[model samples]
Target: MSFGPPPSLYTQSSVAADQRRRKRRRTVLLCAVAAVVAPALAVGAWLWWPGTASDDAKPTAAPAQHRLDVRETVERRPASTQGVMAVRLSTDDLPPGEAHEMPGLWATDKILAKGINRTLVGVAIGTDAGLGEEAWKLRLGGPICGKTRHVTVENRTAVLFRDSADKESLCNHVAFVDLDDGKLVWQAEFPVSGYVDKPDAGSQWDPGVTLTHATVTVTWGDGTDAYDMDRGKLRWRVTSREDCISQGAGGGRALAVRFRCYDADDPQSRSTFEIRALDPRTGRSRWTYTPAVGVKDVRIISTTPTVLATSAGDVGITEIISLDARGKYRTTIPLQGGAYVAECTDEITYLATEECPSLAVGAGQVFLTSKEQGDLIHNANWIIGFDLKTGHSVKKFESGPNTLLRPLRMSGDRLLALRESSDRISPMALVSLNPRTGAETPYFYFSLPQEGELFSTTEFADTVVQNGRLFFGAKEAQGPADADSKAWVWLAFGIESAAAKKP
Candidate 1:
């Protein structure tokens, strides 16, 4: 399914006609609502909102706590690369495969693997599959550049690459291969010229990924494309004026995408932002909303076929907008500074900002962090909580200066914040934060070999939290002062709640 702008700009007469048509539709919908409201209002007026209190209202029990356990950890490295790098995880434990080397190396570039432990897909300058010396490599028809921006796993069957084939044109291609055996299943290419940028321009950003039951949606900057994973064929293409920024799958068998279109005259300024929800199977527009343009830090919070959008105003004013079934403005709620929202349940929303602010339909409570005045410093770190619905600060906690906190995952009542020293020269530490109480408890701190000296250029890879354990990989290289560094090592750590305190 595809969508595009009108063939040409609308004339004055056309604009007036569209307005009249929309206005008439609104009138009919309003009349239909009024006709049914008289009888429904009597029963609804007496029913209290789920979270509110009433004389007959009774509190529901909290959900049962699930224990998180670390099952296993296996380290895999590519051949030729000195660093034991590129670790992919799957649900089942698999043997450590031989490391494969790609053609290019960039600080921001990454290798993706499908599944938990098994090597389902791999891509670099060319492509390869399987494990160890038994792995097979396939040479693409053309010289595969290492500068590919976004590579995604599709339907556990194929890999998609945003390839820059020429100086003026950007092309998207997919390589479908068998997951068990390294065999080419199929390949398709789409050429795009308008949004293409020079290699040095860096306008090509991360592409969006949305996988439906039947098709996988791959949205590039100014164009949207879908692939029938089962058949390995192109479904449709939708081109737009702006770069598609984000996308999400809603419950009502619909897919939503957001994009920003800038005014051509003022290239530095954006003129409009649009959110469109489409039927995933047919590629038909179900609803569209074009909000005011001043929302500088717009981010898509959630999207459902019935409930289309949730977004923040900007970094400073944390106001969230929610759209209704008709693609019309529904409600707006103020959020706290640095508030982060995540989809917790199908019907409820969870937020974990500085501290942790949460809300739900039947029951909800706010968790906050606290600190002392002496803890304040120019670069000091702290975490706080606020009420998501009310925008009120609930609590605050001090984490000390030069401390970096990365959220691994949240499970049950525990919100794990991986704490490490900002000073790359020092050892790393892990800290756990409780979302319910705003308490930060240091879990484990480990030191690397001081003589080797930490590689300042290498970043401590972000940690992943699953089940109940935190996983992280660290890279270190060593060499003579004047010579190029050759010695490299990648270390994986599995962290769990400590049963006994260390002396």
Candidate 2:
């Protein structure tokens, strides 16, 4: 959840998902597949990308098609990292040479990212999302300034962002934006001052929002506020408790909230965590759920239309719990270990494991990747899909088995898997599967140039999949961090043409 913090920053493990899926697969077929697939993927890596001399030692087998096309090359370091140079080309069909360039001012500054209508705002590093609709090359007006965290998309038409460049994380201002172009619909400041500082982690908590089908709710500091999305006017505001400070909140559900109330004076006093659901209209308490004894500071893992997913534990163990909208316990999915994987990613909250996904909630189900609790990556396998109604296993699939095959996206009907390089030695691939039947189909694949290495973990953001495309950012190194210096490359892969079988 901290993503540990990438000013140019943001980070998944899939191991957990593998074990959960393996438990249900009592069959020898899946067991055998798990035993063999990973090395096979690694063995196959050299075929996709050219590598150092070692790769050359092996004979090359020509593949049917090249996975990706280099439309344009990014400039370098600061320019490439800032959101300005990000949207150089929109996905929409464009002229042969029209490309976007960054304003020199943003080279060292940070850029926030948010995805909408398959298009990205602030950061459009490359057109991997697609290359036909008209590329989204939006430039931020000089008015909005912030170390750029992310834009909270309220709807297809508008987005909200905290525009304070102050690293203190205070909310001096917020910008309501139009998706058609990078135009500010409205920019306003919170009536009060300071956004609480999570100084221990070197991060700030600004107002977080929740949007329902009709209303908008935001969590600023210790309280909640409601706004009219169309007019940008405050409808209601709830001041936080005098003794309790609000630590975190979540949105993107049904305009509902599960706010964290902590000791205002000490902030770190997590001995007790109070989760309350607030009325989106009046900011009044609708319901509150308190953790049972032994489990302190129950934190939200994710929220869905049918359930509120959470994690809590006593010492070093963490357990996943699900509650209905009314805050009634549905069931519990127990997990081992602590310290969820932190990522410098946008739009994801739960931490994943080394081999499986950390967690996914959608389509009336909950998903989790187990930690490397017992075995390491090469041996761990399974991904569990749990019923949101009973918190029981709905289905299990032999996730990556020997491979780091991760569920990158979970929609209402299907799950998309992206196979990535683990040691940076394997070639990355993508596939899609039916959560119900476990049917697999090759979606796409790409190779890193043999000359470069994957970026440092801190600069890496998880892959974003939408509109038949995959968008990923990586920091490349010619040497070490101080060596040839650091540069970034954003990869966009169009998967529409090869969703059925490998080309």
Separately for all candidates shown, the number of backbone clashes (residues 3 or more apart, or on different chains) is: 17, 37
User: Where is model 1 more than 4 Å wrong at Cα?
Assistant: 1-159, 162-171, 175-187, 195-207, 212-214, 241-254, 263-269, 301-380, 385-388, 393-404, 410-414, 421-460, 467-469, 473-481, 489-503
Please, what is the whole-model Cα lDDT of each candidate in the order they appear? 0.36, 0.39
TM-score of each: 0.48, 0.59
Report how far off residue 480 is in candidate 1 (Å).
Answer: 8.5
Task: Give the per-residue lDDT of model 2 (tens digit) for 228-326.
Answer: 556678878778766544444544343344444555568566545556766655667777776664454344545444343333533332656677878
Tens-place lDDT per residue, model 1, 342-455, is 222121110101111122111122332222223222233444544444445554445455443444433334444444444432234344445444555444343323221222
Q: What value of lDDT does candidate 1 attain over all alpha carbons?
A: 0.36
